[model samples]
Target: MDFGLVLLLLGGFLLGGAWSIWRADSDTEGRTGPQVVFAVILLTAALLASVSGILYLV
Candidate 1:
């Protein structure tokens, strides 16, 4: 399999997980520090992976 494709898949999964976490956190009384931090990290990683994947494919 292509490395670019793998990156894209991984990015998608990470993005989904980040979104889920953010949504869940929002539904609660207040945002937890750890969950917010984790979600931000995941989102940043996902964006980086997705950009790298796209660049690789180009």
Candidate 2:
């Protein structure tokens, strides 16, 4: 398995997790600040990883 492919898979997994967390937090009541922040961070990381993976493959 190429490292780029691995990174792409990891990014997809992280993106899914971040989306789940964001959705769950949105459905909950007040004071989910930390979860939201974490989700955003995860989302950012995922995007960066995915971009890097694509670049690497190219």
Question: Highest lDDT: which candidate?
Answer: 1
As a TM-score, model 1 comes out at 0.87
Backbone clash pairs for candidate 1 read none
Worst 10 residues of 1 by lDDT: 22-31
Q: How many backbone overlaps does candidate 1 show?
A: 0
Q: Give the TM-score of candidate 2.
A: 0.87
lDDT of 2 by residue, 1-57 (tens): 998998899899999999988878433485398988999999999999999899999
How does residue 24 of candidate 1 score in lDDT? Answer: 81
lDDT of 1 by residue, 1-58 (tens): 9999989999999999999988885555777999899999999999999999999999
Tell me how far the alpha carbon of residue 13 in candidate 1 is from the true structure, in angstroms, after superposition: 0.4
Model 1 scores what on Cα lDDT? 0.92
Predictions: Cα RMSD each: 1.5, 1.8
How well does candidate 2 match the true structure, expressed as C-alpha RMSD?
1.8
List where candidate 2 sits over 4 angstroms from the true fold.
26-31
